[model samples]
Target: MGLLLSSCVPTSGGLPPFVNPPASTPYGGEYANEILKLPVYPRSRTLDKREFGNGNSRVRFRVEGVNVRMIYNFFTDQIEDAGWGRNRLESEGQNRTWQGVYQRGIRLVRIRVQQEGNSDVYVLEVTFLQ
Candidate 1:
């Protein structure tokens, strides 16, 4: 069984919205913050991170012992609360994948969560677009 929650918020014109830190600080620490510029999920293990320069970057991490729905909600709520508007959200039960796109001014962020094989681990990827 699977549950999916999705929403879309209209974008507004003006200065970029201020990004508030997540209520519970992420476990990825400073490095994760520097790379993704967003709160890493608590207790997540970073698997890979890359910078494409010009303010474009991507980070991949593994979240263990948690369901896909929880992780997806965490990031979506956090992003919306931070003043970013959601442009799109989608989830597929069969593949166990969830994705959301949020934007604040010229900054765009894409977050994806997918189950890894048959393991209980889920991999989350966050991409920051310039």
Candidate 2:
């Protein structure tokens, strides 16, 4: 059953293989102030975050029990409202995944939200452009 399979997925544990340990403070910390300005999904859990020496950074979060479209729209609206210009927006796999690129002055932000296969868990990655 769907409920049984969803329960087996670990929501909290080690970072995904592609992600490295946090090079600076995790979410809600004093590092990478620029990236932290963007809106974070309500009730999402911070999974991994890292800051680069070039003033760029990436943060990942996980959320569940929310419609994927709603999650996608939240970021798009909030990012635009924050004065970021939309460069591109695209969705594929029947809207199971969405990506958007926006810019404000010299800074760029790319947001991607993808459902974990058929599960309710959604992983969001936001990259702050230098």
Cα lDDT, all candidates: 0.40, 0.41
Location of the lowest summed lDDT over 10 successive residues in candidate 2 = 62-71
Tens digit per residue, CA lDDT, model 1, 1-130 = 1332222232263323464444766565776555444333544333221221233332223223111122223322211222224433444553455456666345566555565433445555656665
TM-score of each: 0.31, 0.31
Compared with the true structure, model 2 gives a TM-score of: 0.31
**Pairs of residues clashing in candidate 1:** none
Please give the distance, in angstroms, between residue 36's alpha carbon in candidate 1 and its true position after superposition.
14
RMSD (Cα, Å) for all candidates, in order, is 21.8, 21.8
